[model samples]
Target chain A: MVNERSGRAALAELVTSRSVLVCVGSGGVGKTSMAAALALEAARRGRRTIVVTIDPARRLADALGLERLGGEPLPITELIAASSGLRSGSSPTGSLHALMLDAKATFDDLVTRHATDRAQAERILANRFYHSISTTLSGTQEYMAAEKLGELHTSGRFDLIVVDTPPTRQALDFLDAPGQLARFLDHPAYRLMTGSGSAVSRVAGAAGKRLLRAAARLVGSVALDDAVEFFRAFEGLEAGFLTRALAVRDLLVSAQTGFVVVTSARPEPIAEAGYFLDRLAAQDIPVDAIVANRMTPRFTRLTAAELRRIAAAQDAGGDQVLRTGLAELIELTAAAEAEERALAPLHTGRAIPFQQGPFQQGPFQQVPFQQVPFQQVPLLDHDVHDLGGLEQLRQSAFDD
Target chain B: MDPSAFFTGTAVHLVAGKGGVGRTTLTAALGIAAARVGLEVLLVEIEGRGGLAAGFGHRALGYEETVLAERIRGRSLRAEDCLVEYLGGHGLGLLTRPMVDSGLVEVITRGTPGIKDILLLGKIRQLEQARCADVILVDTPASGHALSFLRSPQGLLDAIDNGPVNDQAVAALHLLQDAARCQVLLVTTPEETPVSETIETAYRLEDEIGLHLGPVLVNGVLARTPHRDTDTGHSNPDDPDPDDPDAEGRWVRELGIDRDLAHAVQQAAVFGRRRRDAQRRQVLRLTEQLPLPRLEVAHRPDGIDDLGALAEELLGGLRAW
Candidate 1:
């Protein structure tokens, strides 16, 4: 829970009420875990849900107790069965589903499904250049995330979809994926290359052919022929590609979409989160929640002056028992104070929420980000590799 | 026993790790360490927001190589510039800049799948072969991107059989896969997730990319619970509150502080010790599971404030190993 005004109700609404929840943040703040936990929590709430991860090097499959993840979603029935010591049918509202995005396979599926003719599809699919480059393509992962979301949404298979975006270096790249894909399809150079479809374009490209003939004399004939053939193969599908890319872009900013930003309280990560928030605002994407993971734990309650006076009394009176105990307290107090100092910068744009009492500590004070509701998850005692660990994280997320 | 021997002949020294694990700091420190050994070092940052320059106490560096120290220089590599240089190599010098200006460069770099990484690696490979420095320290992208960046050469080679891009990929591969010329050092924290990823990345670099692996540099390790190596530690570390009846009575009566306060302090110390103990267990797991040599740098409570001091500390650690 972030605070009294907003708490787990916000998370509950994001998971159950919304059609799609996209987790966005800088890299390495446990975004995968948060996404999985949200999906599982939604499933427990009796909503059919699936969480998709676009991180190429992810352990989401391992975290969900599956050996591996592929393009299709695998229902997590056996793991839930193992957890409650019951059979696979014990799951409520079916079960949660998970899959890692296979960029190459998804693109292939798109081509096969959308091509005008089987032969046209086969030519595009079997092109040597397409076969080699699709898997390790740079921007295809982000492009496919949007495409897959649109696919799953139209299929009506899952009521709620939780998606995890890749940790992109440039903050705008992920949001700009659909536009970039559409732009690529509509590029002048690309259209010039693939304009072999219409008779008008074919006759118009005669000048281009003459220019290419001159260049072919300068370069190798075989290489230019292969290049021309690769582009011509996709001529039949160019219009479909542009229209689908534009629709995917529109689906990203649709009313059903919501974004959740996850980050840590560290200085660098906070700045990164600010950058992400700024970009989202520019793009007009609604941010639902902010999750701050692995915040430093606090254990001290008394003020510094009070602790010093107690220490002075222990030293003067020479009681070893009280002295040793107070000494331990002092050391721990210092560590807690240092942690507070580390998080001080993030406390900007908000008043210090601390209030000192005689002996008892008050409720936990929170520093919300830009007045937006946010939840904080403490670092778990162990790494989460199985359903049991994920349950632990879920409990912490709701409790903390 | 020779610390410099690990880096003696390696021309391309790459520093990589999970994001937010201080890869940039370690790369700068390693570059300075190599430079101190009378080796000319160039610290290269590709697509980064000048983390290298910030570390060296300078304003953000640009495309041009800027000297930051006595024996070290820094360069921020961008795809557009690297592509221009690459095209100019093929007798297209006149059309390169205009192509970049008309926004055709981004479409080629971002739209054409593996061209961006291939171009970046091609640039790095050129510097390596040119012997621009005795040791070229590259601060690479975070783990997943770094792996793909290294894989671009082969990806392009497979996609285009024998074009100019294929030639560039072949050149990048020769520099990356030559174990005697290139070595990779991975940095990680003593946490579970980062360590797990570090282990996986190291395997991929060796098995897939075939780059030689160096010692795993563990950062942010803490000191023993109460007793630190420095003087600003607890007054008494081993013994908690000493048990003297007279002292206890005087403090309880005179200070007016409740027994709850003492208990709170005791709880805090226990938590501190427990964290340190957990970290030790994590470190042990890395050592037992990984075959690579490991070097640990303790957590600086204050911080590594200056790059010069950090370089000195890193040099000491390297020599002691």
Candidate 2:
């Protein structure tokens, strides 16, 4: 049997290995909390740490007890900084910082940083197609998240970085982004369509010399006209976007970065996690660990009457009622057992379950991590808007 | 439950809705329901949400179908992947690889204004032509794209007079036009935006694709009943009613509780029922305007997180239909 170490111990060992720690799972799964805890643990152990989150919820700020987070890394003043000042004899071993990504803002920054001139950046940003492509595009958000992660890591600011990835599909897109972006950048049709002259004016000139003329015609003259204008606006920065994408892909392949798949113990999530693992394996992305969040441990024995009562409750009328009162308990045990069985064969790491509780009024109370190791904090009955609430959250987080 | 009864055997199933309206959930549930009766099922997701993967709890899916549940399989089709593979098959493989390798594929796939929709429709066409599955559940992008996606084959067939592309487009149009072979379901929440978008999407898909529009799955509905007034004369929203009470006491006791909370709860229940009622009324209007059968899926509080739950909720009421 695997030893049940403290959350701090498990976190310290994971970060010390110099690998990428990718936190992924479904929405509302407390991925950000676990990521913050691990980063805090790492900082306490003397490693310079950064925990970045792409989830728009900003739960990280609540988890870290900060009023807000900037786009760039800021010192985690509430924990390490405060703890260090309390007692010189008990100085923190390391430093911690946090950053919350704004995807569109980051993409805009990339365009501005790489553009040949202010005029080009303005033009590209102004273009309707570019605007739509940058914001509404399916995987662009994930790609930009990965880009930011790589940028922070390569800057040499932190020894260990924890990325709280977006929801499942988007999280996978973080890995697939580089490849997908490369294809769009290199498509010859794009180059030809976006080339200097007006698509209509150059149609005949381009026809004899280029194969893309017919395809351009297929896209229609009006749309082709619009696409060429957008591309021309993006000309100066195309190469930079390409280069950054390549760098991010290389960093992902590096040994220093490891991905940790975080999920709940539910059958669906576990299966999704397994599928994610399979795809990662297929693509050769290094998976450092799988942390199954919100797992319920099974007791040695329960009376047959209790089991029957549980089964009877499963047949309850409403989906929410059944799920909360009965299905949840039964499914939790089954999921925990299933995850343990699945993780048994893996050579590198094991599974960790962070218990969860039913919803409560306060933001911290809403968080599942507070229930782990079992000393429950009374529900705050108010929203967590400032530093004090976060401190209470931290206390609850480490309650056991 | 005859598997074929769930689907209009001759119709192409186009599942569309606003984002987060649980379109993917409805599609997966429908697929499961159809599969349970032993129909060969092909479930498709176009937005690259891989929500189908989440719905079935798989890791990831590619262009090729992966078995999700018994008798059900699914695939995620992105415009870029389809273009690369299609181009490769047509001897332009080398030309597409560098772009694919550079991560431009996703951009090109999703970046082109209407290309993603076109490619998704094309992929569905291919699925329809193949005899591998008896029913194909297409979990399309949100209504914004879904309308354009359904209309794309027709648009392409009109644009390209005759060619291999046109040939495929025409075949797709044929499959889509065949009412017996294709159907469309609009998934929505009882909320204003989603319901409005659903109606608009339904009209556009029906007009353009000539497919049968099926049901609208209204998710996250609330239910409330009058509180039982105890003889001791106390009522708590948190506490369940002890037993049936007199009408006057029930009203008075319920009124004494938190007004806003009780009102909010009542509003949600009323809103949901009203939305369903409105949808049925609109369906009647639609039948008058453009004749077709319409169905409604009741709101389930827990929402659909998996195929089993989805199947039970969606098909549970189909026996009456």
Candidate 3:
């Protein structure tokens, strides 16, 4: 059996003590809200925390009671107390900051940082391909998120950095993005395109040349030439990007980092969570917790005899409307029971939940828990738009 | 235009929604709805997920179309496969293996932004032009990328002056911008956040992308129970019935109901009413904020069991719209 109390304690310890907390999940799972709430909780517990989110809905700002969040870090410590239903000027000992990822802007910043000079950066940024793919590319946002996370962590800006990953079609994209970019940088296609005047001929053998001709013909020589120019401009920046990608990958797997897989209790999201957990396990990454959000509350405590008695009473004296209401309640209760049954696999050790980290002595070190702490946040009566709602959600998530 | 034509007459229906809003299930139901009207339907899965096929109790779909139901067929389209097909059709098949191996296809399809989306849309356009099906339902990406995915054609037109890819974008744009030929069916749940996102996406798709908006499908709506006093003067369910201050007590005494049972039932009723009221407020907000018509599917906590009933409900809504 899972140790319920220790599981919760380990989760809380990981949240407050870990330097990096990555919240990964599919879309519409309240993953963003959970990230924000956990950050708020960490700050309330007296740790300087920053939540970097890629939420498209802008709900993070609403949850933090901010009018808007931007590319830079926005100090939200002062508003945390009020947002959490406390009086003004009663901010906690710690601080909270929020950063909303602007993929294009972050990408441009990376280009400028890694490029050899301002002119090189400008050339790369000005390329037609770069202009479009910097933001619109499928994996650009995910890669940029990793880059930003590495930047913030390396800058030593905060005690805790909570990352809200992008809502990718496959949740694993967030984890795979850095490697994908690194591989692309090392790919023969990139090498072939970026090879200088003489090197191009050497790199492009007869087959390669013929392939280029065919591609050039299909997309037109002009478009192919433009792409080649873009890659050529980007030639010298590969080393810097590859170095940072490797560094980010290391930081993600470091002991200071912890991953919290957030998911709703729905069948699809739960299954997605299972897939994420398995993938992380395969990678030997430690998943500190699984926050199952928006769980249906079960009322199965009412025994069948009790329900039967209630039904009998309703049938004896109730009108048609009362009968309909009773039937609806019974169905709802049954469904809630079924939902609870569906969640059994998550906690039954059917899925691998924990991985042993390297033996290290620290506050944030893995505590060797028997199971990944599975926390269920009940579906709220209303959407959490502000701090008070987050406070309510936090209590549901962490409270026994 | 006749409301029923939204399903029968439209050549392409691109169904999009934030993830977890039941977009796939609704697409399947819409396909069923259209098929019931004597229209052949093709369901296209863009993300290569088995969700659309799973809706029809079929196995995972591939590049080739498989019959899902009597009048419905389903398939998935990937950028790589579409590229290969385009090359093969143009007698440039020899370039496929080398280009794919050298990662040139990746650089071209993915490296050039919007190229993948344009390729997929171009293939969809071919299916439409060929009259492969009377109605084509594309299960597009989630809301986060749906905008950029739909906007790719227009974006490419401005970026690429002229080329085969540019020509493809022009053709896709032609199909996307034509109202009678294509319209986007946005799905959202009856929740505050989903509704808000739906409104924003709806307007953006219409204004920025210049795409036609079909009726918004509000999935997971709580069905109103019969014999409720909702129609009575009480707008808020929390407001107590002035006639019964202690209804639970009365039930316990008159019907021999246990006090605990009576209280439990009362609690359930209150929770259900509040949730239903909240759902109604969101739907009303959607109706007011978005000028598009709405089709609502009631919540089935167990899941969509009866596609026929759902199709009928959708048809009924379309008829009213």
Docking class of 2: incorrect
Measured by TM-score, the strongest candidate is 3
lDDT per residue (tens digit) for residues A251-309 in model 2? 77788677666655443454445555655666776555556554434421433245446
Query: TM per model?
Result: 0.83, 0.55, 0.91
Sorting all predicted structures by TM-score, with the top scorer first, yields: 3, 1, 2
Question: Tens digits of per-residue lDDT for model 1 on B1-321?
Answer: 454675676888889988867788889888887777787889999887666777676766778899999889999898778877877787666655545543445544453456777788888888987888888888999988888788777766665565577777788888889988888889988776678788889888888878888889888776653433222323345554333334445555776657666446545545555556566767777877889887787665433345566667777777777
lDDT of 2: 0.57
Interface RMSD of 2: 12.0
lDDT tens digits, residue span A1-400, model 3: 3345555676688777899998888777888888888887777777788999876667687666567899999998664665454333434567889999888999898888878899999998988878877877777877888888889988987889999876654445656776787677666777677664455556467766787788776676766777888888888777777778778888888899999988775666665666566667768897888777887665447743456566775555564434554565575676666566556556564532111111111112222324777676777766776777777777777667
Q: Which structure is stronger by TM-score: 1 or 2?
A: 1
Model 1 clashes, total count: 15
The per-residue C-alpha lDDT of model 3 at residue B82 equals 89
Better model by DockQ, 1 or 2? 1
lDDT, model 1, position B185: 88
Quality class of the docking in candidate 3, CAPRI style: acceptable
Candidate 1, which CAPRI tier? acceptable
Query: i-RMS, every candidate?
Result: 8.0, 12.0, 5.3
Q: Write the per-residue lDDT of candidate 1 for residues A1-400, one digit (tens) a residue.
A: 2342464667877876788888877776777888888887777767788999988876587567566898998788655454443224434664678989888889899889887889978887877656644666566777777678778888999988989877665434646765676576656545555553456656657655554443333223443454456567766676765566567667667877778888765545555665566567667676678787765444457755567676875546564444545655665455446545544533343322221111112221232344566676766645566788787777677644
Candidate 3 lDDT tens digits, B185-293: 9999988778888998999999997899988999988776654544231344554442244877876787676676566666666667667767877888898899887
B23-137 in candidate 2: lDDT tens per residue?
A: 6677888888888767788888775645576566575577887999888888888776767666666555664554454333443335554455565566677667776688878
